[model samples]
Target: MRPVVFPHWFHRIRFRCKVCHAELGFKMRAGANQIKMTDIIDGRFCGACHDGETAWSVENCDLCHSGKAGLPPGIFGGHETLGPGRW
Candidate 1:
């Protein structure tokens, strides 16, 4: 399975890890998060908050699963690339 890079900062402010990681029992490893489109459509994973409340809806697959390399655009908003030298 492909890796899904969630917007950590976006979720950090809205909810703690316990809400989805612990409560939903998602693994820390990528490909082990066990999320599915069907589940999300049924209000799981991102669907929990993205149910037209906190962020974009689950129907917008490209919004979260754009299949691009690294974090999606605007995540840092034209800032320098983040790496070992940076934070």
Candidate 2:
């Protein structure tokens, strides 16, 4: 199975776990999301949010699946570095 690096922070804002997990019936573990190109083309998984609302579309593969170990550095823009006090 291919790796699926979902944009965690992006979805957290507008959706709850149930939306993708229970509602969409996705697995909790990594590589268990059961995503497929066919599904996306049919408006599922990445295609669901990547339809140009929350972020870039599935056509922009690098936006989510960069084929890297993790999210590229600075992608979150110091948001992870900040703490409750910083806000």
Residue lDDT tens for model 2, 36-73 = 67887677876676677765776776665554555332
Over the full model, what C-alpha lDDT does candidate 1 score relative to the true structure?
A: 0.59
lDDT of candidate 1 over 45-71, digit per residue (tens): 767767877767865766676545664
The alpha-carbon deviation from the true structure for residue 24 of candidate 1, after best TM-score superposition, in angstroms, is 2.8
Off by over 4 Å in 2: 1-4, 69-87
* Top candidate when judged by TM-score against the true structure: 1
Q: After superposition, how far is residue 49 of candidate 2 from its true place, in Å?
A: 2.1
Off by over 4 Å in 1: 1-4, 69-87
Task: Report every candidate's CA lDDT.
Answer: 0.59, 0.58
The TM-score between candidate 2 and the true structure equals 0.57
